[model samples]
Target: MTQPVTLSVPCPDRDCALSLARAAVAGRLAACANIYGPVTSVFTWNDAVEEEDEHVLTLKTVAARVDELATLLQTRHPYDVPAITWETCSADDDTLTWLADETR
Candidate 1:
């Protein structure tokens, strides 16, 4: 049984977010990618505090492809240390089946 997963990634801007989303879906690495934001993010980097607007890219995929999806983000993401993370999600059987088929 394939388990559904949602990967969350923060992008510096909208274009970067869209690019990643497109790449993953085009390659069938993800069933869907939702781009959200222009949200404000405040974090510390290199011993300094910083605040910036960023877009959040959420990808829907399966457990089997999570690692590959992460690798793709790592290689293509603009941020040096992209915060690529994911969590398991529960979906209806039909949605799950669709996700699996679309990804494949």
Candidate 2:
């Protein structure tokens, strides 16, 4: 059985987040993408602490598509280093079926 996962990416703005979401869904790399934000993020970059407002993009896909999705995000993302991570999850049978069908 294919493992379902959610890929999380941080975007600098809504436009960028939406663009990535559309491309991923269109390309069949993801079944769905959820965009949320203007959330404040605090982190250290290049040896300095920084804070910024960002959007969170969550992509639903199977484990099989993760590499391709990550590559697509890297090519399309606006940031120098985009944060792309995934979490394994359990879903209902109907949701899993829908996700597989949509991504395929």
Q: Which candidate number would show the highest lDDT if scored against the true structure?
A: 1
| Model 2 per-residue lDDT at 17 | 96
Candidate number with greatest TM-score = 1
True lDDT of residue 38, candidate 2: 91
| lDDT score at residue 17, model 1, on the 0-100 scale | 98
Q: Write one digit per residue (lDDT tens) for candidate 1, span 6-99.
A: 9999999999999999999999999999999999999999999999999999999999999999999999998999999999989999999999
TM-score of each: 0.98, 0.97
State the lDDT of candidate 2 residue by residue for 3-103, as single tens digits.
89999999999999999999999999999999999999998899999999999999999999999999999998988889799988999999999888988
lDDT of 2: 0.94
At residue 66, give the lDDT of candidate 2: 94
Indicate the residue-level lDDT of 62 in model 1: 98
